[model samples]
Target: MTVVNKLTRLLNITYPIIQGGMGNISDPNLAAAISNAGGLGTIGVGDLPINEAVYKVTEMLKQTSNPCCVNIPIAVHPNVSHIVQQMINLKVPVVSLSAGNPAPFISLLQQHKIIVICVIATVRQAKKAEKAGADIIVCEGYEAAGINAKNESTTMTLIPQVVQQVNIPVVAAGGIADGKGLAAALALGASGVQMGTRFIATKEAPYHKIYKQAIIQATDESTVIVGRRYNRIRRLIRSEYASKLLEIENKNDDPAIFFKQTTENYHKIGAFDGDIKNGFINGGQIAGLIEDCPSVYDLLETMTADAKQILKQSLEKLE
Candidate 1:
């Protein structure tokens, strides 16, 4: 079992692991499985309408008695207040806000006794979230999949800075896939680690086999950063579609075509329909480390075990 810590206690989870709210193609079954297995699972609210998101939350809640988190990208979804109200009405155990300023909604969620975790990429933003009544801070780095923070801080560099600056628990995200990565985050004084790309390769994720296989087959050089020219930096797996997207982003300064090609529908096409020719998949640099597709339970079990061993070995070596 993972050692008791502020994060686990705060989130009411056995492990200090939080799943990233993988937008659009998020699976309720996959989220519930992670929650049931001791980690905090999140239902990603991409651009889905409020009703559709509510349905997903309901399905995820029905499958797991444990606490679950709903990850909502504040700026991506048009109806932020409506969704927040739905979350309160549903009495969700946790809510993670990202892709926009969370200060406005933090107090509202706290009023209803809902735990709030803000995903940030800089120390200033981390402190801002804490000041805004956020219960936890998930500091994301540039190496993470999908849309990254505008500041582009690395998890290794951002974690300690956020921890030193914020009084609340800090969860390190970006480029983390296994136990050793978790151990490194803890060593940097983070309370836990949040993973996205790693969980996508799990058995319960319900994504396309081709997507999972791509993750398994990925190498250190397999991923590339796109959308930089349009000021929307995102990490994506290097594929024909991804390359095409990058080409458009580079040659075309106008965001019209780039935005059209990288919408939620395209993401679903790549992640769920396994269409790489016309759709692109999101992945982190950690994809290189994912060699197998295990069940969520087994993945968590092995990670905690490995983290414990790795920490112990490091301590011994220090002595």
Candidate 2:
């Protein structure tokens, strides 16, 4: 069953699900797999050098002809301008910007006929992104993994407010892991959904087996937020390293120390190297909901089928 909406029509995808660009984990294999499976796959170029980032995108393009997206963490990428130029040169179909004002580059991307989606965590940010000419808005709530907004609004509250504030299509993120969550997002007035933590547990994801297993075993209380003192709050699966990092953060340790703990290198160590004791893995409260590591195609198929059933049942209830 196809879940069509503004997002699907705009992107020409079979489903409205957009895979979260989980930095190092969003490699070509997984991105292409997701895109090939009918959803928009994303390659996250979080702080990667321009050449390497371009190589990843190029590899993904080679693997699949379907539309895919590249995520640019503006605040962390040292060469935002160069990255955008590369995406334009490659004729990338979609781009999602996060962690900074997207006003400067939104027009530039749109000029090249690229669909730009801005990730926002607040109603004000949604309005600003829409005004900046963003084709779509992905409202990420506090329950999301990785870096989150200081205000920490949950998806249930943030999606409706953003939908009310923006005329453009809205994609809900954070704490959403299954078909039930997708139905809830649609009920909240969102046209689509973005998933990160749940995707991390998929077989195609480049993260280590241990990382995927952790997600399967995680409980509702298994996650924790670190770096609150520095205002760069991040959610992660609680582990020895994360606990220590939290200890330092709680003590009001040097900001640099806290910063070092959350760098991309540590993320790679935990996610790719499976160094759970000394490295940290990003995860959301949705970790508790994942049960297995299925292929991307199987997962999306199941999710879409389940969503249709859930939505149909919900409508029957109202009747």
TM-score for each candidate, following the candidate numbering: 0.99, 0.98
The lDDT leader among the candidates is 1
Per-residue lDDT tens digits for candidate 1, residues 134-239, read: 9999999888999986677888888888899889999999989999999999999998899999999898889899999999999998999988888888899999
Candidate 2's TM-score reads: 0.98
Count of backbone clashes, every candidate in sequence: 0, 0
For every candidate, C-alpha RMSD to the true structure in Å: 0.8, 0.9
Number of clashing residue pairs, candidate 1: 0
* Candidate 2 residue lDDT tens string, 101-208: 999999999999999999999999999999989999999999999989999999999999889888999999999988999989998999989999988888888888
lDDT of model 2 at residue 86? 96
**lDDT of model number 2:** 0.91
Worst-scoring 10-residue span by lDDT in model 2: 19-28
What lDDT does the true structure give each of the candidates?
Answer: 0.92, 0.91
In terms of lDDT, the poorest run of 10 residues in model 1 is: 148-157
C-alpha lDDT of residue 264 in model 2: 88
